[model samples]
Each structure stands twice: as C-alpha cells, then as structure tokens.
Target: MKVLLHVSHLVQWDIALSNSKNLKAIEAKSKIEIVVNAHAIQLYRELSENLLQQLNELENLNIKVKLCRNALRNNNIEESTLPATVEIVPAGIFEIIKKQEEGYYYVSP
Candidate 1:
C-alpha cells in the first residue's frame, strides 16, 4: 500500500507524523510519503529536537519526505537547511495529484 500524507498547516504536523508512525507500525510494507507545503514548510527548518527525532524515526521507517519548492520560496526556507532525506518537488498540488493517479492513497492530516 502507498500512502501520501499532505500537510499544509503548521498545526497539522503532529497528527501527520503520528499517523505516519501508526501506518508503518500497522503495516511495515506500506510505502509512506509526507508532503509539506504552505505554512508547514517553516517546520522543515530549524526543527525542534523532538520534531527532528520524529523525522529521523520516519527515515528509519523508510518513509519519504517531500517539500514544495513554491512553498519554500514563499516561506523563505532554504533547501539546504532541510533534512538530507527530504525531496524538493516543483509543486505540491501537482505532486499530490500525480501520486493519486499512481494509486497512492491520499491522507490530509
């Protein structure tokens, strides 16, 4: 199973991360990708220790992290400051649509 998690607001990070963790725990074979856009892009920079640990856990689980290039520019977040595992996409909405077309279950948390 492929899951695409869409996180647009800063406040949704916790729930999104929690859901990703739960999904992996429930099915280790599940493919998970977390996409960040809008205000959520800010969280990708200068992450708190707690959030950094959570992201490391996601990496350990083999989950992919993607950030929107548009969002990064709009939020003034540098790509270099993000986690090495994160992929920067051209656009978040387009990426989400493409993932769905490829049969990835979309979850907005």
Candidate 2:
C-alpha cells in the first residue's frame, strides 16, 4: 500500500515522524510518500539541528517530502532554503487528489 501524507500544520510533524518511524504497523504497507504544505514547510526549514538530523534520517528511509509551490510563493519562501530532496509540487491539494486517484491512502498529519 502507498501512503500519501498531507501535512498542512506545523505541529503535525510529530505525528508524521512517528508514523514514519512505525511504518510496519500499518496493516498493508509498501511505500510511504509524504507531501507537506502551508506552515509545515516553514517548520521543516526551521527545524532544530537535532530535528533536522532526524529528518535527514527519515529521508534516507525513502520518505519523499514535497512542498507546495503555491504555498511557497504565497508565503514568500525561497526555494533555496528547502532541502534538495524536497520536491516542489504545483499545488498541494491537487497533488493530494491526484495521489488518491492513483490509489494512495491519504492521511493528514
């Protein structure tokens, strides 16, 4: 099973990270893809040094973190500030819809 995580809130990173850490707990799990937007982007960017290290570890675990291009533009966040692994999606909501249409389980955290 593929999971599409929609991260719209900053504090939800705790849940997202916890879920990522326990991926095997999911009833039917194969691949996990995380799509982040809104304030989550800023939180990821402003993570503490230790938290950043944890995020890097998560990245190595094959979690794909995506940022919404529209949100970045609206918030005046420069793309360069984001980690290189973070992809810019055209629209966060649209991305969620597309992922669901493609059979990914959508979760908001």
Candidate 3:
C-alpha cells in the first residue's frame, strides 16, 4: 500500500508523525510519504531534538519525508537548514494530487 500523509497545520505535526508511525507498524510493506506544508513548514525549521529524532526514526523506517518548496519560500526557511532526510517538492498540493493519481491513499491527520 502507498500512503500520502498531509500536514498543513503546525499543530498537526505530532498527529501526522504518529499516524505515519502507526501505519508503518500496522503494515510493514506499506510505502508511506509524509508531506509537510503550510504553517506546518515551521516544524522543520523549529525542530526540537525530540522532533528531529522522530523524523529520523521515520526515515529509518524508509518513510519519505517531503517538504513543500513553496511553503519553505513563504516561511523564509532555507533548504540547506532542513534535515538531510527530507525531499523537497515544488508544491505540496501538487505532490498530494500526484500521489493520489498514482494510487496512494491520502490521509490528513
């Protein structure tokens, strides 16, 4: 299964991450991508050690962490400052739609 997890609000970070983790645990063969956009983009720049560790854990589980380039630009966050594990997409909405077209299940948590 392919899953697209969306995080648009800052408060959704923990819920999104937890949802991703739970999905992986429930199905080991699932392909999961967590796409962070909008105000949630600040989570990347304002990462606490715990948050960073959780993101790293997801990477270790082979989950893709995607950041929206437009959001980053709007928030004034430098790509160089983001964690190396993340992949930046041109737009979050575009990415989500593309993934859905490709048969990934979309979830906003």
Candidate 4:
C-alpha cells in the first residue's frame, strides 16, 4: 500500500508524527510520502531539535518527505537550503494529483 500525506498547515505536524508511528508499526509493506506546502513550510523551521532529528530519521525508515518549490519561493527560501531528506517538487498540488493517479491513498495527516 502507498500513502500520500498532504501537509499544508502547521497544526498538521502532530498528525504527521502520529501517522508516522502508525505506519511504522504496520507489518505490511507500505510506502509513506509526506508533502509540505503553503504555511506548512514553516513547520520544519519550528520543529524542536529532537523532533527535527526524528523527522530526519523517517527517511531511514523509507518515509519520503517533499517540499513545494513554489512554497519556498513564496517564503523567499532557496531550494538548496532545504535539508537533504526533503525533495523539492515543482508544485504541491500537481504532485498530489500525480501521486493520487499513481494509486497512493491521500490523507491530510
């Protein structure tokens, strides 16, 4: 199973973290992708050091993280400035659509 997590607000960080726990607990083969856009881009900036470390660890667990280029542009952040774990996509909405079409289950978490 594949899951696409849509993150667009700061409040969703908790949702994402909880979802990560659930996903990791599963025994079945599954893929988790977390996409960040809009105000959620700042979510990373606000993360506590421990949480940030945990987020980086998600990559090791095979949970992918993505950030929208347009969102970064709006915030005046350079794509190159993002952490190595997060992928920079052209657009968040488009990426969501593409993932959906590819059979990923979409979740706001």
Candidate number with greatest lDDT: 3
Candidate lDDT scores, in order, read 0.89, 0.78, 0.90, 0.83
Task: Give the C-alpha lDDT of model 3.
Answer: 0.90
Report the error of model 2 at residue 83, Å.
1.4
TM-score per candidate: 0.92, 0.84, 0.94, 0.89
Q: Each candidate's root-mean-square deviation in Å?
A: 1.2, 2.2, 1.0, 1.7
Q: Which stretches in model 3 have alpha-carbon errors above 4 Å?
A: none
Candidate 2 ranges with C-alpha deviation above 4 Å: 25-29, 44-47
Residues 1-109, model 4: lDDT tens digits? 8999999997996788678768878843688888899998876554468766866778777888888888888887866655777788999999999999999999996
lDDT of 1 by residue, 48-99 (tens): 8887788788899998888999999998888888777678999999999999
Tell me the deviation in Å of residue 31 in model 1.
0.7
Best by TM-score: 3
- Which ranges in model 4 have alpha carbons more than 4 Å from their true place? 45-48
Error of 4 at 18 (Å): 1.2
lDDT by residue for model 3 (1-109), tens: 9999899998887887888778878998899998999999988777689978987898899999899999999999999887788899999999999999999999888
